[model samples]
Target: MPSSLSIAAFAAPLIQLAAAHGYVSGVTVNGGSWVDGSNPNWYYQPEGTAPDTPGWKALNQDNGFVSPDAYDTNDIACHKSATPGETYITASAGDTLTLYWNTWPDTHHGPVLNYLAECSGECTAATADGLSFTKISEAGLLSGSNPGTWATDTLIANNFTADVIIPGSLAAGNYVLRHEIIALHSAASANGAQSYPQCLNIQVGGSGSTALPAGEPATDFYSSADPGILFSLYTAFTSYTIPGPDVWTA
Candidate 1:
């Protein structure tokens, strides 16, 4: 599928795009339809007025991001001051989730990662605290030097959308999906990396028997000095090591 990106070769930068750092605008469950999965306006809604979906709300105002300086706080878990989703997405064990972002800047070269955490009960009641996440999907530095073609670049080429697969062998349960993109545009400096993570709840029901894999807390996922987190995209690099724990596949 990387061949789809060849169009980017003869037609990049010159597109004269009105770029902006973006957020999850919609999500498609099982490739069926699009829904406003992430309630972007949860902060401004009157009490109990937010849209009911698996997507949680955070303080990522104006498509803002959480800096590495706040990596130690819960803000790093989702976004700044995130709250749990009020509902859950009804999905099976092996479903494909399509995440659509509002926009992503071409200058923001970085990796894309997704993590999964199981919840004992309904995930709506689950918070970022005490949650452990195992990397499920990640891609970075797909090819070439000159900083390489990153996952974020692919997302931009695909109209700011990404697809993640749910482990087919996963056991029936409630879980939270943490999807993130680390923009390394200014990551050359310490604490200059911008982390934009969004969380959503999922109710998976199937006969598969694999249990949730062991995971690490989001706060412990990365350090400001990590090679991937504190990187300079301006340099030429053929390979990039995406930060966070090894991906868990069932």
Candidate 2:
């Protein structure tokens, strides 16, 4: 029922968003130099296979995302067929880390969250599936209507960068840092949400004695029928509940 110009205008942004699928290009700890376990130079295309990085490599080389239809599958753990990184980055509790995304479309707005799962031993050799993840950080609807000032908006305002703070009370160990962004631009319909989750292997060192518990697996992270996952942003809304377990605190 829309005119040609109206349809074109509407499709323009969607096309842009599709062409600019995102990926974690690099990460910095305590405001240090940027480092990436995977390809740091991912643009229109990704470079040759990454040699080493604390960040796990997902199948989103084309900057693609995982839809809600795959919620119950192992693909939701990290991205899709995610492979563990060969090494990890060292950091201490209470350290702030910045995750850099290659690009993010403002049109795609939703929630941003982080989770941590400690490995039995060396995380470098750990697998993506079956890890118990505990929510550590979450930023949902910040303010305004049309889900205004969302975490994704703030991320865009900050040049496609998201900051995550390591829990100060977490025990020293090898862990997997899972950072995710849920794009709810088309969430009005079923299976419309787009999930962009990535992982990083971190060797944490601190005197804190609180070891992360064996939390719920990533498959139980969300359900297709969840209020947050099946939400709508096309209309006005005042509040938004982040979909997932409560964040683990000291």
Candidate 3:
């Protein structure tokens, strides 16, 4: 058995290591803000909740943790498992929403993407397998001397936040919003890319006449074998194709 003194000495370091992993701990919609791990409306099923939920299963996952890297896999879409409550942030078209994460390390450099999927009806009970999504916003590597790296990107870099515009003409409805980051620091090796995807419930109100494009299963986006996901980002890349469908800017 270990001595109490020894155990005490090791406890602090262990706690720090665990806390180092990051997660989206809070979000701001328009002028309203809510913290994660505590907000019932945010859609994260606490790990301590009885009978674990099925959507965004990796809710509150440490930033250091990554899901199985196979494309079109279950964990790729929303890291889902639990059926989140239907509570959502209410916003009109042309509003701004911001997501805040825990400490984001500079070493995890990659692209940031946002997607939206309209719900069939009530979103609180919707299953992850039954949902479909459309690309809405994408931010790739910044252009300059050090290209293909997200380390210097303003929104990502050492910051813990990102902001996105709600399409001015978005139709009125309830939709699932997915925010993601692809960490490519280790993409040179097979199955090395780390993807962190989080989902939220939102009720969008707008007079916009545009309709969502045909929905595709999360697996339809990219294959694990795709070059963009498996390639090394150590060198300069002139242009990058975000690994997903075109954005529906309308």
Candidate 4:
């Protein structure tokens, strides 16, 4: 039998594990639901529910996955081994896309960022290391009146869902939208910030032929010592520095 101290130690990690988990369940493009597990044709097919199975995409399993202590590595891009050959969801360039998560912990307060990568050829064959992403949208701690933290931002706080508008002026083509959440509750410690990123295959439809601006690699997003990821959020603060490339406007 485990001793009282042993039991407490074992329970502590479980508590932490439960607090840090979450995943995007569905992507809504142009009013259609592309549920991850339900529609394998539009999204990567999760290898039945277990992360250890063959064809299981690493980041999709949010049981206890987190990333590098800093932006020194490319793992920040897609979390882990991403599912390839996913069918791209079709949408208009200006449409508003919604990303729905299973559930976000109320305590995990931080910014939400959305990115887009125009595929050079076929998105199904694209790999995380080969794709270049443009910051399309990012929301940080809100200011004014009552003031708002990213955790308390609009529908994201209440519904675990956030929306970003597709750039209307963007040229139509195949692309991947990456929606991410940075949980900073334990960020004061080294490697404490949890970055959850989900990439969705997409095909944009528009007559515009504007070229996307230059962007940075996911590995370039942060450093282990970056103040944003190593700072405390439990005190009085006015603003926040989102730890990625600037949002690109075409």
Candidate 5:
């Protein structure tokens, strides 16, 4: 029951050449840029508020993507079930829950597309990012958690969608769901640093279906159905020195 799982090199590609004109730069993740008063590189903490139970509402500054300098788009947030402790796992009505974004990253700001190229070599881009989660109530939650202190829930918007609802009177076992992706860079005080945080570890079951429980490795490996076989296995392990070929001393 495995259809797809990818996030190794995400989408490795970040080529760039100026004077000669060669472009394809676009790959940056985790190492996008961050430092100096750092605090909002991206965040999400749900299990049960902290200090007491009345705080945790930043959702990346209410969807503005947090801009004291950066994060203009690319965010997602979700939490349902009364919103008190965020709970909902009891399936038995047309069960078919599916939310998948198996860790994606190959470009966000380092493959050099318009940020003055510098990733170098065949263009080894780095960030392509992705994540999603949905399910809201209690005024659509939005992002709140300051009761105990340890609040940080954000969702920018280059892309994000998460919705989970399974309360048909569940009574199974094993059920957990958590997804995260926080890569911030409010301009990093004019491109100094701060942008490196990509996470995804989700598991939702009760007969619904949502598993990313550590299994994402295959970001488009130059597919052609194994035709060249990595250039014929690098020309059969090249070590050419066949003058007259000692053909096994035959």
Candidate 6:
């Protein structure tokens, strides 16, 4: 009887979800100056409604506030004010945070709008750092299978919220929230100027581990342009050296 034989197959693609997780916090813009065509002083307006009064009045209400002066000559001056408890979610390693903001026609401009979560250290209040902003999510901007970029001239309308995903491998610690609108144009002119709105602040917390899996080995075959199996009846063996892992110690 022939000897018992067995073979094992170990060639399969490794698939994974990457262990990246994320969350979202809602933000509310309120309590700013409203430019209605009435009361010259700043007044208050209801949520989600423009000031009904006339003559460019400043609305002190949290929801419907407008600025008195047009920051840019080409663009109309508007105000954006967010509340204290705007951000509500926290994040950790293998996780993300998606910030939801109320949309308006004039809110969507080309600027680096960011949402950052702190893991250990405190988040910076300065607009220079501590935020992660991306272009508005439009179609056909991104090449791969992901959300695209914001379309030029695409204003932030109602029910339109941008998704700010925190990196999956971020460390765990306390986090603060803020936003900035870099003025695209200095003043309103025929050249189409833009102005950025003030940033708001909020706080959150997170805790978790961020460990990654080990690497696997790769296989390859040897090949030569030889016809005869027996040449000098000699076989030579060769070996290769792979670099070792460079570990970092905290």
The per-model lDDT (C-alpha) reads: 0.80, 0.80, 0.63, 0.65, 0.20, 0.25
Q: Report residue 35 deviation for candidate 3 (angstroms).
A: 5.4
Tens digit of lDDT per residue, candidate 2, span 1-250? 2333443343343345556657666788887876764542322344554366787877665567788899888888888888788788889999998887766788898999999999988887788775889999899998887757899988877767899999999889898999999998888899998898889999899897887877888988888888888998978887888999998876
Give candidate 1's whole-model lDDT. 0.80
TM-score head-to-head 1 vs 2, winner: 1
Tens digit of per-residue lDDT, candidate 4, span 88-180: 667787898766565556777778888888878978777878778899988767763222357435544445568879899889888878778
Say what the RMSD of model 5 is: 22.6
lDDT of 3: 0.63
Q: How many residue pairs clash in each candidate?
A: 0, 1, 13, 1, 50, 41
Better of 2 and 3 by TM-score: 2
- 40-62 per-residue lDDT for model 3 (tens digits): 22334454563322124344333
Model 1 CA deviation exceeding 4 Å by range: 1-19
Off by over 4 Å in 5: 1-59, 64-86, 92-96, 99-171, 182-250
TM-score of 4: 0.79
CA lDDT, candidate 1, residue 168: 92
TM-score of each: 0.89, 0.88, 0.78, 0.79, 0.19, 0.32
lDDT by residue for model 5 over 1-250, one digit each (tens)?
Answer: 1122221122112111111111111111122321111111113335333222111122322122211123223311111111111222223322433322222222211100000111112111211222222211111112222111110111112211122333333333333222222221121233322222212111223443332223111121112222211112112222211111011100
lDDT of 1 at 66: 88
All candidates in order of lDDT, best leading: 2, 1, 4, 3, 6, 5
TM-score of structure candidate 1: 0.89
Ranking, TM-score, top scorer first: 1, 2, 4, 3, 6, 5
Better of 1 and 4 by TM-score: 1
Please report how far candidate 2 places residue 13 from its true position, in Å.
Answer: 20
lDDT of 4: 0.65
lDDT of 2: 0.80
lDDT of 1 by residue, 70-127 (tens): 8888888878778788877777889898887766788888899999999868778877
Candidates 2 and 5, the one with greater TM-score:
2
Model 2 C-alpha RMSD vs. true structure (Å) is 7.5
